[model samples]
Target chain A: MAGRSVVDAGAPLRDRVAETQPSPASVIATEIKGLVARGDRDQARERFGALVAVLQRRALRVAFQYLRNPDDADEAVQDAFVKVFMHIEQYREDLSFDVWFMRILVNASLDRLKARNRQQRFIAPAPDDDERPVEQVPAAEASSERRLLARERWEQVTRAVANLPDRQRLVFTLSQVDQRTPAEIAAATGMSAATVRVHLFRALRKLRGVLGEQA
Target chain B: MNRREEPDPTLADALDAYRAAAWAEVDAHFDERALESQRQRILQKVAQAGQPARVLAFPGTTTSLRPAAGISRRWISAAAAAGLLVGLVTGQLLHVLPGDAWVHRVAPRAAQPYPSGRLTLIPAVATTDADNALLDAIDVAVTSRGASDLRAFDDLTFAYEPR
Candidate 1:
């Protein structure tokens, strides 16, 4: 096994910040919006799949950051896409469709989180029950010792991120996981840009402390 | 101060682990098949939501009595007849019930023309052709053609008086 630390096994990240050019999803969404305005819901729905395909992975990633469980994240994504189609008319064409869709996805995730909290109050889970469906990708090349250490660090990181306050977690996930700029995060989240940067700073500072303790 | 513009290098490095682990889990959980299934479900849900909500018709609460489109004319006639029968039965039951409370009546003490005023009605009897002819004679004189026609009224009689 190659001597790869947790830092070395980085996720294949997409540079969404550099996607400044016009998005094809926005074009499709605008066309669907027009069809919906004309009362041609069937045509609008027919064209919505392209939009879903474009945003599904990113939506799942953002949703998963809020709702740690994969199934809940999936449900949240579905809810977001359905909401997008149902309320396509509300999407302002002058703005980026990604921001509008991200807003919906975040709201859906929060809704799932709230629903899960309500359910948990009534039905508490067992102490040892692993609530998240975290399937460890089998990096067969890594030695057993390295794999174990990676998994342990993974758990610690996940727990630290999960323990953050909702806004801090949101900003961190958007900035780190989704690679969105602070300005973009503010637009999607409805927070002021300064507020977004402050949240990001707080989240990073907290993570640094958490990792330092773990180290 | 400008260092604050860039995130701390150590913190960035530490965050990679979380990003890596989270992405691994997301990718493992939402594979191609799972994503496709989710896509289909989203489409189905949107299609369902795009349509109007289903309304259940409750007879008691509905404000408009819209005629049932599927009902035939014969059925309508039968319904009308059944309704008529129910009304007639209700009317008969009201009549036979004790105290006759359904009928509003004036007291006999209050049933006079003016409480104590006198009035009379003639006794009814079957009339013969002679009676009709006498009435005709009276009518001819009373019509203002001439009072000389009153001569025919001389033959008029109560008829039973002679009997």
Candidate 2:
């Protein structure tokens, strides 16, 4: 069992995935499933609360990266949880619920994206509409030059990620933002492992292209 | 850790570092208060789900309280099926009963001449003038095909008749 350790960026990604410990959300999810089966939905919901607490921050982080809008991310997260609760009975206890839930979250975010797209089609956005930052990180300690450099890099990366096609963006967000393995991403997304790898490769290539151009 | 060869190790490392920094920045952006507020919202939604929701009554209201919107689509389908079955059985029962002479009056059944195994395509219930006109038009169209074809049509119809 891999202990809780910071991922080594220098190492290969698959090894880091292998070293990922079982998530606390998975264990609590199993307990919650049992409670639901026993006809104690109230208790099951209570347990579900704990699972959400464990996963929400990570969930929000992934959602925000994918959506780039805090309101959309917040709404998507809420929708995902409600759907999770409603479908708790269908959950297979043997699998990692965290991955299963991430699948649902990704789907929910996609749904919001489609809806926003539809709305945009019917009504053109105002000229003032901008990709607002979800939250501004205050760089109090960093030098002014360093802070400016970091901001420029952040903008470049964000624009590169946002320019990716929908499927590539989703694959990149899960693999890069959330640090999930290709195999795990395949399971979560109901895609073949090879397909996940191809997507990840294409996504990285695009990002690298963007970075190259910026350079 | 994956066996896939890194196309550009330097680029991979740069991306990884950038991802780590972004994660840290975003994680810090969301404070404890915001998360707790979200938590309370989730718990409140769950609590509301566990209880039976009531419809507010208005003056001179006739609509009854319905099950909460959170009810599954499966349950809604099951209820719809049950209602349909009840309607079908009740309709059959009403037909079986000797009462409801008024129903018979409104929906008078015309004795259909089956044409004795001939392909009789008469409208089952020619209640309207338009229906009768349509049936007449069909009769004219079929009769124009000649007697030999009519006999063949009857034979085809008999082939499809239930045993």
Q: Which candidate is the best by DockQ?
A: 1
Top lDDT prediction, candidate number: 1
lDDT of 1 by residue, B1-163 (tens): 1223656665654566567767777888799999899989988998899578987777654435344533566698899999999999988987787632432232333333433222222112213554466567557656664555664675684435544
Q: Model 2, stretches more than 4 Å misplaced?
A: A1-22, A126-141, B1-10, B56-163
Instruction: Supply candidate 2's per-residue lDDT for A211.
Output: 73
Summed over model 1, clashes come to 0
lDDT of 2 by residue, B50-121 (tens): 678887776433333233433566688999999999999989977787744533454446546667564555
The parts of candidate 1 lying over 4 Å away from their true place are A1-20, A128-145, B1-9, B55-163
* Pairs in clash, predicted candidate 1: none
Per-model C-alpha lDDT, please?
A: 0.71, 0.70
Model 1 DockQ vs. reference: 0.29
lDDT of 2 by residue, A114-188 (tens): 898888898977674333342332344167675555555566667778788877777778887788877667666
Tens digit of per-residue lDDT, candidate 1, span A1-215? 11212111112112222245657888999999999999998888889988899999988988987887889999999988987887777776656678667767887888888899999998977485344443472354177775665666666767788789888888888887887777667667766678888888887777778878987
